[model samples]
Target: MLTKRIIPCLDIKNGRTVKGVNFVDLRDAGDPVVLAKQYAELGADELVFLDIAATLENRKTMHKMVLQVAEQVNIPFTVGGGISSVEDVDALLHCGADKVSINSSAVKRPDLINELSDKFGSQCIVVAIDAKQVEGEWLVHLAGGTIPTKINLFDWAIEVEQRGAGEILFTSMDHDGTKAGFANQALAKLSDIVNIPIIASGGAGTIQHFSDTFIEGKADAALAASVFHFGEIPIAELKKELKQQEIPVRI
Candidate 1:
């Protein structure tokens, strides 16, 4: 069995790490560099740094900050937001990002996924899909979950995989920051739909939620923000408990 991954997300805005509920009402968490180092040393499997406002503000990810944070940790780092072309991914990788995540850009031009995976290889490309359920359909959202689309979440996931995306990061707008748990049902369905790994995001409040997402949701990884940012759950302890539960995790 593959070892499930625990990832801490750094949602950056104005050069500071921030967190919000349902993708609104942002608050400062801490310095990205400091938090990055702490999470790496604390046993996080990977780190994701997203410039949450870069797409909205129409700018590239802060390469200077990516370089700074990249210098502090030895783990694989993924950078996202305002990344639309092959040039942007190249720039971030040169700044030490092992992987690059694309969202709005991919949705706008689906061919971007093919171009990126072709240039950088599928292992380094992650497609982030932020969607929320509307009545009965889960529609994809963009611009930091501020805009909704008619695109079905499942359909997009399948298309991205077919385009050569290595993984998919799915964030549930409704479950985000609610701490209730992850969208396991949707995740399970996604896992069945795609052969690529799925990283479940949103609604992680307790350790049990992690286990549930991995087991029931069939997720290969679980990513969280506020819980780890606020020290509400320590990475080491969470991994220890997951291991005790017979979940495959690297200690």
Candidate 2:
């Protein structure tokens, strides 16, 4: 079986790491480079650095910060936010991002997924869908979860896959920062619908949540922020516990 991955997400703003609940009321987490190194040393299988305000601010990802963070970690890392064109993708990848995640821009121009995948190869492209459950249907959100769209989450995931996205990083806006658990139901449904790897984000609070996301949610990877950011759960401890529970993870 393919080993499931544990990833730590660093939501970046102004060169610092920040995270918010339901994508609002942001609070400082720490310096991005510092956190990246810490997570890498803690056995994080991968790391995600999202320039949470890049799109809203109408600027590109902080490439200087990305290069600094990239220097500290050995694991594969992904960078997202304010990425709209192949030039943007090329810039980030040149700065050492193994993959570039596109969200708002991808929704606005679905062909961007195709363009990126074609240029960088599918393995270098990730489509991040920030979604919220409304009236029983998951709706896509953009610009750091502040804008809503008509695109349904499941449908979007399928489209992204067909367009050649190597992975889908699905974040439940409703469950983000809740720390209750992952949106496993939606994750499982996505896993069944898409052929590419599915990464579940949001609502990760406990070790059991990690196991559930992999086993029950049927996710190939689970990404979290605050819980891992605040030292509420150590990556080493979480992996050990997950292994005990029979979840295949790099130890």
Candidate 3:
């Protein structure tokens, strides 16, 4: 098995990093560049910069800020938010992002995943799915997860893989900011169906949550916000704990 990666997520809103519970009540966490540098120094395998409200608000991603953060960090970083087209992906890559994640746009234009994969290769296409469990259904959401679609999460994930997406960044909007634990059940199903890597996000409150995400959720990488954002879990120490638990990880 490949080593499980511990990734720190930076949710940028208006060029500032923020964290919230259940996707509401967002509060400032730190400056994006500073937080990215800190996570890089803490031994994070990778970092994800999400312009959380970019797509929802009908504007492009904050590129200038992304450029600043990318130049300051050493590890591979992924950028998302309002990335609706190949031009957006190209611009972000030129700005220093190692990978580009697509969320709402992919849901509305599933063909974009295939197009990007063909143009940039599957490795560069990360289909970031924001899902919520409502009435016993895992529904896909759009526009920073403020809108729900009729698409089922499992079905959509399969389509994304078939369309040539290299990976999936599955964030559980229901568990987001809950900090109780990850949505392991959703992850387990996704991991079972998709051969590509899955980055589990949301509800990561403690060290054990990371372990559970890998072991129980069967995720290849675990991404969290507040715990790492507020100094609740040191990235290096968390990776150390995962190693001790025999989860393949880079320390």
Candidate 4:
């Protein structure tokens, strides 16, 4: 079995690492470069740097900040937000990102996924979906979870794979920063429907949550922010707990 990955997410705003609940009430966390280096040293499987407000602000992700953070980590780094075209992906790759994640832009122009995959290979493309459950349906959201789309989460996941996305990073807006647990039922549904690997994000609170995300959510990787950022959970201890639970993980 493939080892389940534990990824620490750094949500950047104004070039500073931040954390929030339900994607609001933001608070300062720390420096992105410092956090990146720390997570890499602590044995994170991968690092995700998301410029959370880039799309909503109508600007590109901070290249200088990405470069600074990239310099601090050797792990497979995925950078996202305001990434719209092939040139943007190329620029980020040149800036040292191992993978580029696309969300709102991909929703606006679905062909951007194909373009990115064609240029950088599917393995380098990560399609991130910010979804919220409304009226008993998981609906995809854009512009940093502010704009709702008609796209269904399951349908978009399959479509992204068909369009050649290497992976799907699904963030549950309903669960974001709740510390309750991941949306395992939704994740399981996605796993059953899509062939591509899925990265489960949002609502990771305890060590058991990580294990559950792997065992019940059927996620290839589990990504969290506040818990890791605030030291509520340490990566090494979390991995150890997951290993003890018989979940295959790098220790």
Best by TM-score: 1
Better of 3 and 4 by lDDT: 4
Q: Which RMSD values do the candidates have, in order?
A: 3.8, 4.0, 4.0, 3.9
Off by over 4 Å in 4: 20-29, 55-61
State TM-scores per candidate. 0.92, 0.91, 0.90, 0.91
Clashes of 1: 0
Per-residue lDDT tens digits of candidate 1, residues 15-35? 777764222122433667777
lDDT of 3 by residue, 1-251 (tens): 67999988877888777764222122433567776776677788998887867754423447877688777778898888778898888888878788999988888888999899999899988999999988999999987679989999999999999999999999999989899899999999999998999999989999999999999999999998778766788777888888899988876
Q: Which ten contiguous residues of candidate 3 have the minimum total lDDT?
A: 20-29
TM-score for candidate 1, residues paired by index: 0.92
Which regions of candidate 2 are displaced past 4 Å?
19-29, 55-61
Best by lDDT: 1
Question: Which structure is stronger by TM-score: 1 or 4?
Answer: 1
- Looking at candidate 3, what is the lDDT of residue 63? 80
| Model 3 residue 106 CA deviation in Å | 0.8
* Tens-digit per-residue lDDT, 2-97, candidate 4: 799999888788777766422212232366776677678888999988887775342334777777767767788898877888988898898888
Task: List the candidate 3 regions with Cα displacement exceeding 4 Å.
Answer: 19-29, 55-61
lDDT of 1 at 251: 87
| Steric overlap count per candidate | 0, 0, 2, 0
Which lDDT tens digits does candidate 2 get at residues 22-120? 221224236677667767777999999888778534343388887877787788999888889999999888888899999988999999999999999
